[model samples]
Target: MRAAIHDERGVAAIEFGIMIPILSLMVVSVTDIGLAVFRKMQVEDAAQAGAQYAIIHGFDASGISSAVTSATNSTAVTASPGPVKFYGCPTGTGVSVVSAGTVCTGGAQAGTYATVSAQATYYTLINYQIIAVAYTYNAQSTTRLQ
Candidate 1:
């Protein structure tokens, strides 16, 4: 009985067996998070691509939408809310929209601007108790056309 209690045989195996599940969980969690981050970047890039298209070719709703959708490899990405065209003046915070041909407070002329938005739904491989199974990612980009 004393020898049996003192036996170290199979201890490494037992430890490995206990650690296997933990290590697997950690690896899978990391992979899931990495994928989520990658998808978010794709969404952001899609929005930026749409804005760039509008800046280069002017704001065409259909063309901007197409650019957003085609900018990423993921088919889940979409151009949400389409594209918007407005006249705005550059401000300290951001673009301040006003009437066309309106002069800004700083004596700058209002410029035509386009905004593009992209959205995607990310579904996790595994659900966690604290985290949701599905997450929505949205991105927007704005650029001056003139």
Candidate 2:
């Protein structure tokens, strides 16, 4: 009975078994986080690409949206149009543009401002099954059109 109690033959195996689940959980969590970060960066890059295209293309809604989609190259993310606000101030601090080429106040010109933005639906991998939580990721870029 004493020998049996003192026997530690299977101790390593028991420890390993206990640690396996924990290690696996950590790895999965890290993977999920990495994926989320990658998706976010991709979305931002896509938005910037669309904005750059718009600056040269007169801010065509369809074209901008297409550019964003193409940049992302992911079916999981959907690109949508964002608001186009104009500003007389270079910093866009005062006044808003009401029309395509007009500003609500100040000396801001209509063709002086343009913006491109993209929004995407983000799904969490870990809690997707337990609770359906969806997040929206939005990115925007603004430029002055000559």
Candidate 3:
């Protein structure tokens, strides 16, 4: 009836019902975002660990990847293939770095550096691939060799 439409009774209930889904979505989004950030930090730490390992023990692809995998301690993340890269550069002055190609062992100079990268894919809670809701995440670290 027109009087029922004009009346404000039960409006709060209707509003609450409408807001509930939006609030729930917000909560889920926040939770997912927090988890994504945590995962990103873990990946970054893994990359840093791998880079440090390479710096100390020289570049061993398997060892570096193992370090990454161990650091994360999660099966959801997979270390990228050929994650280690070596750069040779002049030390103690203006420097130019050149890629050591595929081979890295015994190729680094005093000022040379090693870079390690880690990557993983996180499946999103919502299925929205067009918005990049789920995609590959990458982390990288570089350390100068001693």
Candidate 4:
């Protein structure tokens, strides 16, 4: 009687098939996480830029935003990318400020100075999902003022 042997080709194919999907998934996950971090930074920087603009120029929130946009990615800040918005000034003080921009309005007699806040959103290709679903990521930013 001669010794019998079985083919290993099928086993190799099976292993390869299983590993390909897992490897692909791992690559995709890494890419997604990196993108998320990048976008979050963008939002924060944009907000800071907006506030900085107000601080130096006085009013004209748009001007600061424009500076930020020019410095960074404008598309990341806004879907349409219009002028930076300013709103809600204190009743007196005569310093132009926006209410929404102001974080805590009443620190020094209602118009002494205002704290400013700004926000920006970033988009990513990865859509987070749970149990077969999808989601969108939202990024935000804020700044402080006198």
Q: How many residue-pair clashes does candidate 1 contain?
A: 0
Q: Which portions of model 2 miss their true places by more than 4 Å?
A: 83-87, 92-111, 128-133
Q: What TM-score number comes out for model 2?
A: 0.78
User: Residue 134's C-alpha lDDT in candidate 4?
Assistant: 31
- What does the lDDT come to for candidate 3? 0.74
User: Can you write out model 2's per-residue Cα lDDT over 1-146, one digit (the tens) per residue?
Assistant: 99999999999999999999999878876887787777788878887887787777875777777887888778655456653636434435633445565553457565556676777776766673655556677777777665
TM match of model 1 to true structure: 0.95
Clashing pairs in 1: none
- In angstroms, the error of model 3 at 137 is 1.2
Cα RMSD for candidates in order: 1.1, 3.3, 5.3, 6.8
Residue pairs whose backbone atoms clash in candidate 3: none
- Badly placed stretches (over 4 Å) of model 1 are none
Question: Per-residue lDDT of 1-146 in model 4, one digit per residue for the tens?
Answer: 23335545578789999999899878987886687677667655665665566666765655755755654554655322333343434446544554543444555432333233334544444454642233233333323343
Residue 113 miss distance in model 4 (angstroms): 4.6
lDDT-wise, the better of 2 and 4 is 2
**Highest TM-score, which number?**
1
**Candidate 4: clashing pairs of residues:** 87-98, 87-99, 88-98, 88-99, 113-146, 114-146, 115-145
* Segments in model 3 whose C-alpha atoms lie over 4 Å from true places: 1-8, 85-87, 90-96, 99-112, 128-130
* Candidates sorted on TM-score, descending: 1, 2, 3, 4
Best by lDDT: 1
